[model samples]
Target: MRLWLGLPVASALPRAHLCVFIPISERSRKDGALSLAALGTWAQEQLQRDAGAKVRFVSVGSTAGSPLEPYTLHVPGDEEVGYKRLPVRILKIWHYLGQEDDCDWVMKADSDTYVNLRGVSDRLSCFDPEEEHFFGVVHAIVPPRQLREMWPALYFGHGGSGYVVSRGLLPKVGRSALPCLEDMLEMTQGDAMEDVIFALCLQRRLDVQVESYGFLRPGGAWDAQLAEQEFVVNFHQARDELLDRRPKAPLQRWLHWDAQPPPLHACVMVAHPVENETDMMEVHRKLRADAAAQVLALAPTASEWAEPERMPLGLGRAQCVPSPMALARQAEVRLSAAGAPVKAFWTPKQLEQLSQCLVHSLGKKRCGWTDIREQRYGLSYWPPAQSSDACAEACCRSGADCSLFQYRADEGCWLGRWEESQAVASDKVWQGAVKVW
Candidate 1:
């Protein structure tokens, strides 16, 4: 039931405690809701529905929203640029760790990035609770062209997304976050991708082993025609139409901790009873604690886990999506990854009506969907790549676990003892090997 492979024999791991922090930078007034209050309301609406997944609405930047109870974030000015976002997200995770006692893991994601809860649960359900490791999107990040435009010294990758981490690295990351933040601003690229900088930070700094699963990849990789789904935390800029409102697949069944049932009986813990403000607060608090314990306990033991549900979609998942349609036709809209016009009319009344029946949404507007066997991130090893598996063979050959590094092909990735370099291959040839990963 547990997957902790390497250990010191005496090294001990407690239950995996986790806190999912959705770092959202809603343009204080982009939705034309007219005021920052409207932004908060819109964001909260999305955060509330997913209360079951045990996440918090961490509103950052200049948006003056309501009290983010049970959850908190840094409020920076709108004019802040180049790495400001990273510090805000870092500070939030740091604050949570300081307050909690049992937390063993933490996931920071984008608000728009859809989270596949069942997908995540299934992944989280694979632990043994006695190993040391960390997991997250090992973004297929390319180094910057110019030194100044490049990520800061401590940071290596670009904009991080919905990913997991262990408490082992928390103290180091938390302690170093600010210095890296200051360096980000100094670069003055004026770029605002916080995750990118964060990605680099985790890859280079944390000395622990990191695994990337493909079950976390959200929808864009989905092709109804190809039937190549397998994604969990769909990320990198997306839209509403890009979102599959359809009930892709269930990631879990009703979970019962009471039964010593299969340890893999992973359940999606939704924070319920968010009927009022106080209810929202309580639900948020309880969910956070529960997520912390669930993940911490499982991390050392579980082979893998991911937020299988579409990360309540936002710009995070959208920007990375290689959509067949134009950005204007995305399911949701906001500024582009470059902070340009990501707004569009897929939100038209007619589109809205179409959105209502997406199957994932039961009366909720622009609601996220479940993670099918397809549409996963770089966490789980099950769903073979619709695109890449260069590392899988190596991993299996060595009798080791595999992890996916970032690649550009529309395929999937593997984690745990994977091949290091990408071999040149054609699309058609690679497509045939999709299932191998």
Candidate 2:
């Protein structure tokens, strides 16, 4: 489909679905295993669970490639993979991966970042591979007054937060389709940030936009509340800045509020800023536990957990097991007690009936309603809808002003003019009706 670095872009050989690359420094590795150690095992676990998945994790560095237990790729460059030389490291990654032509997508992440490989796959599902799409938490590029003439207010994805590059655009690197390493190093005087350089290359050279995925949180932008409900793909913790509100770069604005962690929500796929190797392992352990809890929640019957053999992690029989429906009710009660307005309770059968009737009345096959129960956000409130269909209709009728709507069988409908970057986990909330423009 494309060609670059004097090599064929697409080959007849089998290709992995995604190639996740993390640039590492000898200093970081000396500090500990780096996030890749746990991540490699995590990736392998995912592969073991799903045979069809072909995702590879490779840690790239500038030094001589010493054989790591799992995987490592050494690119020729200066040994220091620090801020100033980040562009070189990144360009090297692209060039190497591009020549391989063994993956549909190339994801460049920092060693400090933890990636949820499954979540990455899920997010990429909606996008097409043929198109040159860049996915990440996008930031607007605003230069100082002095440099306004030279630099416009453009946008780029944060490298620490990690970003994805489609295979289609990989071959373009170091060629006319994209800037060569020499040009990039010269243009930035070898001191430019890698993410900014990447954004510039995609926008000016390839005329492509960086599609922002709000779920990818970086710095103090991590929302502890939203992660409880939404499927957050990744989180970036660069240095001690995960909790710091200070902007990493003068060109980027610090938009999100600060939030703490510890009781990491089950909905978060990837988490960032785990600078400590022990913390990285702990994060993975906690995520595995949460995943197991999800499996327990989805169990068909409480009796299933009665057997000691089936019980996992020595979960005692004395543990009071609650049904999924019961748990949902408990969550609703908590929200209701905390100032959430009470609404009518509809049985499953009744909800299904309402859903069918609303579909019939609205004459739309797909209602587009998402069961975001235990989640709530936005400032606008509208009359309650009887069903998710009714909420979608209301949002659609509200015109361009409404970008999304949250509906609850009990609490009714809420319209949002702007797409919410964060939503708190609440009871009985169903978010849907994204206005297609």
Candidate 3:
């Protein structure tokens, strides 16, 4: 009984869920109607056949009350061309939905066009042809060879490569939560259009398939009439006219799924391996907020942490890990008996990574890294455990401090500074680790 109430057929789609996300510029729609002339009906036809298909038509626009500061961000240059930002935003929304809802297939495309539905359906249904799931495109943009003669730069474009994506292939949100590829591009190189660069993001960040659709019309784009007869999903202003002539939702005439579904109770979807990406950013977000509070408490006497450094900082020389249960004797310390103690060296790169992780987890603060020598120590952020509170409280009572963050593997907690009667290294194997007296 996981009851979710939404549009009809929400539950039925997951077995073969295909999500159609069409994000159009609200003002960009032609002729004063949310529906494009002749396009809406045909787009609907592409989806009508599948009872599980969910077609989400979204219009993006800035509200009147929005302030000027947001103008640059809200109306990025890409909006003028109806290029890729809105699609990115729409995918993000769909991703958020997938976390809570039950759609497994995601189809993102333009508003004014028609897709070849039957051709797409045939390609889609053939999940095991060359590969089970992949990216299909309608067109490709490529520069030409002899184009150097006249226009010199207007050659690289291909047609009939459709855009298709399956739901099971979504990218994991990073635990470290990397920047939007566009932002990264701006910092690395001068900014470039996201449409051209989006492919790179998919390959580098998400590592999913990004091949062109075998049945797409490419750059020239398909018109309403020929598109209807040739493909299952035809693009642009042609759907309504096509549907109007025939007058029926495709669901009435489509194929019924023959595969019997497994029982719903505890049915499992083996999470697609991120391979390396971590999306447990929520864990780090909380860790950061907590660390910020703790840090503020650390040097409250100072107005802010960013005061220019009068001197370079160090974590101090080596420390030692004392014998275990030593605290019981007289504020004893416990060292693991197994192997050499771990060395907690503070490299600048590691420090910066830690700081970024903290900032990412915690939001920007008035303070920055300090120049003080590392009299104090820090630990990696691990996810919280049930015993975390007890261990943290015990350490605190015993005069210790700690922090927790979600690692790529799982939630981990790191214990920090501990008082010792005899100085010891926190980790012994690393050189120069000794406990402070």
Work out the TM-score per prediction: 0.39, 0.58, 0.35
Model 2: per-residue lDDT, tens digit, 178-224? 25567786776668888888777777777775754323333353343
Which residue pairs does candidate 2 place in steric collision? 237-273, 374-426, 375-426, 384-412
lDDT of 2 at 362: 37
lDDT of 3 by residue, 1-437 (tens): 33221233444544434555455454553311323321233234433343244444443454245221111123122233234333345334433443434444455544433333322443343242223233543222333555534322211111112244454554342211135534543554424443334444444555543442222222222233122111222212222232233346321221211111111110111111111112112211222233234344555664453232211111001001111111112111111111223222222332333333333333332211112112233432222222433323322322222221111222333333333222334322211122221
Query: Could you tell me which 10 consecutive residues in candidate 2 have the lowest summed lDDT?
Result: 314-323
In model 1, how large is the Cα lDDT of residue 430? 24
Candidate 1 TM-score over all chains jointly: 0.39
Candidate 1 lDDT tens digits, 1-437: 32111111222444333446554445533212212231243234444343223445455443344454434444333122224445545543553443333335566654333343434433433332224445554333334446435432222221233556555566666665656656666764325466555655455555443343222212232232111122322211111112222245522222221111111112222211122233223323333343444554546454242242222322112121222111112323222222112322122432322222221222211211121122223232222223333333322322222332222354444332123324443333222122233
Candidates ranked, most accurate by TM-score first: 2, 1, 3
Best of the two (1, 3) by TM-score: 1
Report lDDT (CA) for all predictions.
0.35, 0.51, 0.30
lDDT of 3: 0.30
Give the Cα error of residue 126 in candidate 1, in Å.
1.6
